[model samples]
Target: MPSTDSSEAPNEASTDASTAPWDVHRLPRADGKTFLVTGGNAGIGYFVAEQLAATGATVVLGSRDADKADAAAASIRSRVPDARVRQIRLDLADLASLKASAEALRTDRLDAVVHNAGVKFDQPPRRETGDGHEAMFGINHLGHFALTHWLAPLLAAAPEGRVVTTGSFAATSERLDLDDLESSQDYRPDRTYGRSKLAQMLFGFELDRRLRAAGNTVRSVVTHPGGALDSLTPPRPPLHAPTTGERLRGLPAGILVQGKEAAAWSAVRAVLDPSVSGGQLWAPRIFGLRGTPRLRPVRGHLADAEVAARLWSASRDLTGVEPEFGLG
Candidate 1:
């Protein structure tokens, strides 16, 4: 059995002041490393890709649309000048295409993959993916699950590979209905979306456990960008161009919430912070809504080992792909 004790992992409080609070603007250089950011074409994912690219790492923007992905890459290059950015066509909703998408990366080693892509519907008649699963749960959780399985080999090949799963603060209030993983029975927009993110968080923790049990070098860490709003986000030209009026409208909310760029901090820290360990949850420092990314204890259902294990099993059965982490 994998040891459940987390005592051996470095505690955030124990780290020296110099590195305890990470500077999002001045990330550690990752000259030769490569990272993939799913849904990098827009929103928080785009900023994550841009920040990673600034570190001199080859950042790949994984998106369903080639045009959008290319535009995002170009935007990053515009900002970073000499940024080494690439794009791969990735549609998490279509599970059948993920194997080929992973293969298309064509890299021997992948230092990290930030699973940032997700779908949420505010008003819906309830949608399902091509795989006949609920859209939000399908793309948000199972899609990344299958992608991770296919990318396991490349991740295992890295010196200190990391799988950074982007979760959500909304998940805190939600619980998984293990019997109805598809949400076909109790489908509400917010509830279903929260449950999907909860599922992703569970998968992250369980993946870490399995990696430890198998003695794999790869690590899985989970992070959530708390309360990010587009109106507060700075424009990225063709990608995101919030108007002056929009910024003014969002000013009141800015005190409690943050822009998408600020929201990317937790995931960025999870990827680049050497002190961050597997099975940890990172979030914003202020009310978990807006501030610097900080290490936070996994509480409530997020730490429920039994649920995580069951979810892992269910994910395997649903996706038809066992994440062996190269152990097989």
Candidate 2:
């Protein structure tokens, strides 16, 4: 495991999922603030909830499959006796699902929204969601975009709230497909996934800029797991049993960051560390492109201010949901 000494967590303290960084010994409030994590059944998302629930926060799993969600909640409660886990069915590929899930939230004060769910198809195929957006692009980027839009009110109501999105090293290589938002021209397995990740990073930075410009106090933060180091990477192994394929490629990420521990750090820091500013990209420190969660700068042509703005505008047009929260 990476040394906890280097974390920029509150008070420069070590960070564990269950305990706040030295800065925040108390897990955030469980009283009224609510948290929702996408793809919370297994891997990092599950661990995020585990830590949050263990510390006394209410969490809802945004899952596409109800059964998997139920299992996730039961599993968490088994581990953390005071877990407040709820399930909401959401399909990132479906716009209606995004809207429905957003409306399903009964709590008004949404302390945080984590977009951790993602997919990387191993084969090359021209796929689009029912909404006509590219499969990888739609689900990975647009789906979360829409969900964030719907939940803006929940975020705005909080005295101090945040929105965290997960991106990857693949994003540094991805160029904005402004001419073709849906990746219609050509499709390669890994590159297409990279394109989606790139879009995700752009969205995070752009969201922060928009929020700042609109005068909303809500903090917008973006974090990424090292390339192929994240828990939700391809060739997903069984619940407890990891396979040979993942082990070989992810040796660095695994060695640097074990299981959910690796993916959770940057995200946990982004939320708990108040010194962190908006539009900053956080990854691991050493060989971060492959392991641990550390704050690192990623420079790319696609992340150009002009391109980010263009992508944000296009996302609004595509989702038919204007950027209302931070665009005051």
Candidate 3:
């Protein structure tokens, strides 16, 4: 766990999640705001959607499966009777699908877009996308890269637009090389996933720099769900139907891990907290693995400006999505 000492934490404290002791339930009213959450059908993403909807935000769940998305949205409505929520089919593994999804959202003003969809690991031989790129790299980083580009116009048009990409603790421990982003030479599931997440962190920071330089109103922020588990999460059919093995696994993690809802505090804060700014990274307050959300310092490769710029260029080339800044 990372230390929460003021000296160690990054960025100064602004506003708490709510007026009452950093509680997520008391989030500011989001009436009339619209947020799109990728992978909202499951895990931390689903809880993110639920939390936003509870606060009067119009939540759009981006799921690869329409049925699963519908189920998640229905679950949200069931919990929050007045919750305005819907689902859109978005397969992160497919670039074509991502583009189309972005187009579908063109007419909507997106207050925030949470890039939360991701694959934890790839099995032996590794899966590839339609573009023949590694699954984790393509879906986690490249796919979101293109989607954000397509939606840049909509984001910029909003009063306070935000792009919150999900990051991971793996970034601090694992190695990465922007030169070989797809991991053609070195292919391991854990390392590949870590590199992809590092890329995401880089993209978030680089994006902020570009947006600032271009004088754009949109903000780019990054967040990580620290040690969250399904067994600890509220039951949402299709997404959080914990198995026997999963329950067994959760017993120990339940002690060491935070619930998905708790983990989502970082993302929710990133999107809705007026005090939070672009380029900041949010994570658990206690060692970055558990407790309330807080502004955390970014270190190592994730903080390298030159490397981040290079990664940004590589992303643009790989995804073929031109940067949209200061444009109508």
Model 3 gets an lDDT of 0.83
lDDT of 2 by residue, 1-328 (tens): 1234543444233434554433223444455557888888776777666666765678889998888888788878887787888978888999877777987878877888888888888896788889998899899999998889888888888876788888876776567668887778877768889888888888888888888887788887788765433432433223334566655766655554444544566676666555556677776665554444455544556358898888888988899885478475
Please write out the lDDT profile of model 3 over residues 203-237, one tens digit for every residue: 88888988888788899999998888767776666
Q: Which candidate has the highest lDDT of all? A: 1
| Segments of candidate 3 deviating more than 4 angstroms | 8-21, 243-249
Clashes of each: 0, 3, 2
Candidate 1 C-alpha lDDT tens digits along 23-104 = 7888989999999999999999999999999999999999999999999998999999799999999999999999999999
The stretch of ten residues in a row with the least summed lDDT in candidate 3 is 10-19
Q: For each candidate, what TM-score against the reference? A: 0.95, 0.84, 0.92
Question: For candidate 2, what is the TM-score?
Answer: 0.84
Which residue pairs come into collision in candidate 3? 1-287, 2-287
Give the range of the ten consecutive residues with the poorest summed lDDT in model 2. Answer: 231-240
- lDDT for 45 (candidate 3): 90
**TM-score, structure 3 vs. true:** 0.92
Off by over 4 Å in 2: 1-31, 227-238, 243-257, 290-292, 326-328
